[model samples]
Target: YVTPVKHEGVELNILPPGEDLEQIVEELWNTGRPGPEFRELLEKSGAYNFYDFIIIDSAPFFDVRYTVLSIYAATRYVVVLRPSIVDSRRTARMLRRLMKYAKDFGLSTPDYMARFLGVINLAKSGTIEADALLNLKFTGVKPSKGFNPFKHPSDERRKNLEKSIEGLRKVINFSNYVLPLNADISRLEFKEIIKGGKSDNDLKNTTENLLKDIWLHATCQK
Candidate 1:
């Protein structure tokens, strides 16, 4: 699900998965003009509510339409990358295509150019210095740390989850959002996947850190 946060006086709209962009845009324009009605829809849909931060979580790679739509709609773009060669290549290619599409659609310019945030790295390990450097060349966001000690259903699962989170966290950090990998997220067993299950301290610390990061980032933007 895509989560949006609004803080300060800046307005942010996060479009997550399962949302129809065309429909949303249509609804926003239904009121004749893109003004209060669009803003009202955003609030009514729980996408915004006077806050100054918005985060939209898009679906996986297989679901490309939503991802493209989300990126197009976003005022800032945050691309998540991994240390692995394959993942980095894929992300780079995706960015290239996205930029090309934006240009083709007349959405690329100085005003919109700054909106293309940067790249983020997730669960990086092994010899990825070269890969990371290349990513930076593409104007991606590189964080100073990685979220280690990920928890999963099993040892193997944990490892896999760690890999994914490493990539995801890097991307998130690049976006200037310091959302840590919570051990408690693994404890949330939902018959299929677990969200988190870390000790209270770990969970609390993670949440606090994330909030602090958000506040600092927002303040800096202002």
Candidate 2:
């Protein structure tokens, strides 16, 4: 039902508008035979065991429905977000609420946070504050939700957390994965991003390390 289109060296599987596959997916979702979400179609696509990963980069026009579908389809997700202290805190709180809502409505399973790999900050290069937020280690914290360590270390427990983080600042450079804002990459399509990033040796090395971390994150999950 789907064909893989080759763009440059990357192969893309697209579901364009008015396609029969799209119509079939819609029919299956409505009839509730296989499932009510797009994720079921993805599982039965015969592509899972063939590829190490399949990224569904789609605009969430249906917001909650699409978000839940993507979350369900993918084993894990990596968030690309800007590094801001307040926004870090807000992101954690918002995700907890989303998980609860998704669970209550049967849209998704619980423990949604477990599938989160990590965040890649889009902050400007040489930004100390952003680096600190990105570099903070995620271990030992009781409630280490996504970006939780980046939130203000206001309380006594959080202060201990900050102390632990400060000790690791020099040792573990997790912020090495941060992809600073670049005009070339901004708003670029998937194929373009892949093509443009191939020439940069520094980017290639860092991306390789990031992929290793992502695989470890997936394998280490319970």
Index of the highest-lDDT prediction: 2
Model 2 clash pairs are none
lDDT of 2 by residue, 1-222 (tens): 356799778777764535474565456557653232455566576667767667665333334444555566666665444455454544454455446534533444434455554444455544444335344532111222333344564445435433543433322223336554555445554344444553455444544555566667656533
What TM-score number comes out for model 1?
0.41
Q: What is the lDDT of residue 17 in candidate 2?
A: 38
lDDT minimum window of 10 residues, candidate 1: 134-143
User: TM-score winner among the candidates?
Assistant: 2
- Give the C-alpha miss distance for residue 149 in model 2, angstroms: 16
Q: Report the lDDT tens digits of candidate 1 across residue range 17-86.
A: 3557558656655656443454445668764455456556665375555565555444555555544546
**On a 0 to 1 TM-score scale, where does candidate 2 land against the true structure?**
0.53
Each prediction's TM-score versus the true structure: 0.41, 0.53
